[model samples]
Target chain A: MFDSHGFHQTAMAELAVAAQVSVGQIYRLFKSKEDIIEALVHDDADQWCGEMAEIQMRMDAGELTIVETFEQLLLHTIDEKDEALSFDILAESFRNAAVADTIGTMCQRFRTYIRYFACAANDKLSGEALDAAEEMILACLFGLGHRSLSRPRLSASSAARLTAEMIVTALGGVR
Target chain B: MFDSHGFHQTAMAELAVAAQVSVGQIYRLFKSKEDIIEALVHDDADQWCGEMAEIQMRMDAGELTIVETFEQLLLHTIDEKDEALSFDILAESFRNAAVADTIGTMCQRFRTYIRYFACAANDKLSGEALDAAEEMILACLFGLGHRSLSRPRLSASSAARLTAEMIVTALGGVR
Candidate 1:
């Protein structure tokens, strides 16, 4: 209900009806609609951060290329239906401060991971090159995700692979 | 008012006050709020199409590279305050059927322009290569616009130039 209808549009009455519970039951679990969304945001952030950690570990163990590690992480995140719903809410988080803060934090964490990976991939590249590469990869991932929502013909795995190729190609120019 | 507050938040009374007219006067000009937004979307589409046509003419005259022409056109469109407002409204148009239809039509026109330029620029490339180039450029433009909204330090012109260079380098396998 919250995925299709926005946070503001999902009323307590509708939620109660959908859950087969009284409005009081809703209040017991959530203080307000904002609380529900905030909880969702936190849960998603934790999951994303965990994925980033796992990818980093794989990279450290020489089990994955920086590109492959990041692509796998992103593909896994987007492939989950619940994760996709959470992502939609986060994208629309521009309308809500709590959601925006959560998203901003997650983005920062993701960038940190990218920076670390870029440094590991090539220590000689200047900070600006690394920043640009990270920016491009991040943009490609989320942009492709948003595009895929409407253009279902483009699979998430394909988009992730393309993003990985672009990033690797860009990084090859760093030297 | 509608641009910032959204359609539901902007009452007819508020709009009438902004226009220095009675609430009834608004109904006289348009049947409903949706009607007013529809008119705005129509005007926006026409303006963008006109600008795109001018760009095409310049490109045909050898005044710019295909990538440069498209980037300039997009940068100019995003710089227009009215167009930005229209973009914001169109972002929400997913919730409105009529607005969605208008936006879809406008997007189709833009895609056609991209296809034409991509084909012209990469005349020797295979169909798949041309399609990849087109999608890469489009993704860059989308990313640049969305990023610029949050980080105004990156001017549209610089972003456009960087995006063009990135696309050309990526497609030519220079990087």
Candidate 2:
């Protein structure tokens, strides 16, 4: 709804009314509409990062096979909430700096977290090798999720096995 | 513009006016808004398939390295037209049978094309192994392209190398 109306058309007063918060309170806490947008983006990113960390921990502890870990990642990334949040942020980011900054911060943090997990998943990976592994994993999964938006999707389990196998073959160290 | 207004808010009359075509002409050619949307989706998918066929030919001829081929694919996929087209069709597909059917057709065609290319790239890969490889290539590239939307992207060339190398490793053959 906000996307349809756009940030520009949707005023802070209207937002406060819609949110059932006093305009004074909205301004007092968020400072401005842009700040409010930034805060929401941050909240969404935090939620995603939190989920990713849990998945990473499971991977680190070897609770799931490489494929299962990938499946989990795909399910989360392609899940409707995450997909909507990503689309919303990307749509807004083109003309908005605060949103972009929030996203950049989130993605940077995500990179750090994923890199750590990639290493933990297989101690054999580190340095540049680890970086590539992280990039490949993230990029591939994002692509798969985006593709699923309009077409038939691979089952999460199937995608996980395929991805896990690919990563193992590529990196040669995942157990 | 359609995305900002959304599929529902964008009227056929408005679209016809924007395209400088009469409503009668629009209806005669496209049948309805959903048909017009399907036509657009088909146009984009056809263009993408054409591009892929060319890449496969070059790869088959040894005129391009796997990395170069991948870089070209990324440039095309992440190109503004493709991304916007994909997003538009996807946004509409959630509720429209015409759009969904159009996407289904495009995906089926794409799958056949990708499968053929995979085998050509590595005659040794077939059946399940080939299937897995095809899935990996497409999915990873999609993910990489999607990530690039919000984050700084790797040079198309670097991404090509990274993706090609991963696919080769996964499939264990590429000539």
Candidate 3:
């Protein structure tokens, strides 16, 4: 419901309609809109963790380079549903600590995965160096995701090329 | 109104109430909700262009490095209202050609500004090389902006340090 109508636009009545539940039933379960949002973020986080676990395997096997993984992540961020939900959660996180914690946890999970592969590739990429590189790569991924929305016509190939180069630079010229 | 409630959540009735006008008045001004959004995006683009002009002067005066300018831009993306509105507009652009055009124009303006400084710094940093650097820097800026939303406690100083380092790397170590 939040994905379809956005978190702010998804009123309890609308949610009840979408979920095939009585309004009274919703109140019986979730305390408020915030409560529903919190639960949703938790649910999404659990699923994302599952996805990350698989990605970790690929990272270890060298099935996909970090740049390729980031490209895929960026593309996911551009998805209409994913981007909207993410933007809403991120915007709400500014005012809601529960949401903030959820996002922070998700970010840490992603960074850990990236760091795992990055360290394996270059032993020197650790500590603050690792953190900085991860941050840059993540930022680039996030930026491209946002760009996907504003510029639907934005060339994925061009973005991919520049981002790959950026990842190399951030990784201290390791490819 | 879009900034506060997002594009979809901000209804005509609420806009009338906020703008101190009748719903009829709004309908007369804009044929539909899409028209209103289109107008808003275009108006915002004009204002953003003016800001870029000022930044260009500062760039010429050597008052701040491109990294510093980017830091300020990154921080603007972190602004609760600014980021929300931008995210909303960028998201809307995906579905609306008018919004997409406005955003493309806005992006071109910002890129031109960055290209000017970049070329002045490194005559070789023109064409594809400059385009690549600006894209990376913009992506980094955009990424940090989203980070600010997700991590409310993220320190500006730390973000600045990492981003400045990123700018140097993106410019091919041109600092």
Candidate 4:
């Protein structure tokens, strides 16, 4: 319902109907729409962290290059439903303090993972340089996901590979 | 109105109240909310193109380097309200085809501007390599705008400078 109608546009009644549950039941489980969105963001973050952990393990085991890990983790294909939900929540975050808090917390977790990758790729990258690199890469990853919305025919593979290379280059030119 | 309440959630009455015009007047001007949003996007894109054109003129006059042009054009500060409206429309574009077309056309114009920057930065960047570079740079620019929502404390200047350098490097190591 949120994906199709947007977060604010999806009324409790519409959500209840879509979920095949009573509005009362939803109220019992989630205090408000924001609460429901927070839960979804938390759940999604957990899954993403798990994927990052798996990739980190591969890197630890010497099975994946930094570029390969980025490809699998950040530069991977985006699911349309997930992308819509993420943008929905992100857009909502601008107006809702609580939603912003949730997104901020989730981004902090993601930042740590990105920092780990940066450190692994180049130990010399620390302080402001490291910070800039991480933010640049994060922005690139977020931007890549958004590209599909405007340029659907543009292949993700070449973009992904180039982004991965860019990350490698940005992180002290190591691949 | 759209920035705070969202596109789908904002009704004609609320918009009328906000605009200090009658709902009937709004109806006379715009057939629906989508029409209003299309007008806004078109207006925003025109302003963006004007800025790009000015930057291009500066680059042509040798008053600004390619890096400087990108810093001024793509990596400049993002207005919070504009950012929110963009994300709002981008999210809506996922579900609304008409909105998607508006965004797509705007992006095409922006893409041409990016291509010009890329070509000027590196004549060697051609065909698929050029396409990849443009998309990568576009994603980075978009991502930088979004970073403010999640991580407000991070300074954009360093990121912007680094991103400008990264673009130069990615375009073929010419600044």
Per-model chain B TM-scores are: 0.78, 0.83, 0.80, 0.91
lDDT of each: 0.62, 0.66, 0.65, 0.77
What's every prediction's RMSD, in angstroms? Answer: 4.4, 4.8, 4.6, 2.4
Off by over 4 Å in 3: A1-36, A62-81, A94-97, A115-131, A152-154, A173-175, B1-40, B61-82, B90-97, B115-134, B152-154, B173-175
**Local accuracy of candidate 2 as per-residue lDDT tens digits, B1-175:** 4655544457889988989999888888877777867777778788889988998888879998765666666666554543433544555564456676787788778877777766655778765566666667777656665565446445655555565665666666321
Misplaced by over 4 Å in model 4 are A173-175, B173-175
lDDT of 1 by residue, B13-108 (tens): 899999999998899999888888888878876887787778888999999886687567557644645323444454456566776776667666
lDDT (Cα, tens digit) per residue for candidate 4, span B1-175: 7777777677899989989999999999999988998999999889888988889999999999887877786555443345667777888788889988989999899889888998988887777777777787777777887777668445667677766776676576422
Give every prediction's interface RMSD: 4.6, 4.5, 3.8, 2.5
- Name every residue pair that clashes in candidate 1: none
Candidate 1: Cα lDDT at A94 = 49
Using lDDT as the measure, the top candidate is 4
Q: What is the C-alpha lDDT profile of model 2 across A80-130, one tens digit per residue? A: 443433454465554466676777787887787767656655778755556
Give the clashing pairs for model 3.
Answer: none
lDDT, model 4, position B36: 91
Docking class of 1: acceptable
For residues B1-175, could you state the per-residue lDDT of candidate 3 as single tens digits?
Answer: 6666666767889989989999999999998777876777677667766776776778679886766766655555544246666666555554567777867776776677666755654566655556666666667766776665344233656565655655665566432
Better of 2 and 4 by lDDT: 4
**TM-scores, each model vs. reference:** 0.75, 0.75, 0.73, 0.92
Lowest-sum lDDT 10-residue window in model 4 chain B: B74-83
Clashing pairs in 2: A139-B143, A139-B144, A140-B140, A142-B143, A143-B142, A143-B143
Worst 10 residues of 1 chain B by lDDT: B145-154
| Rank order (by DockQ, best first) | 4, 3, 2, 1
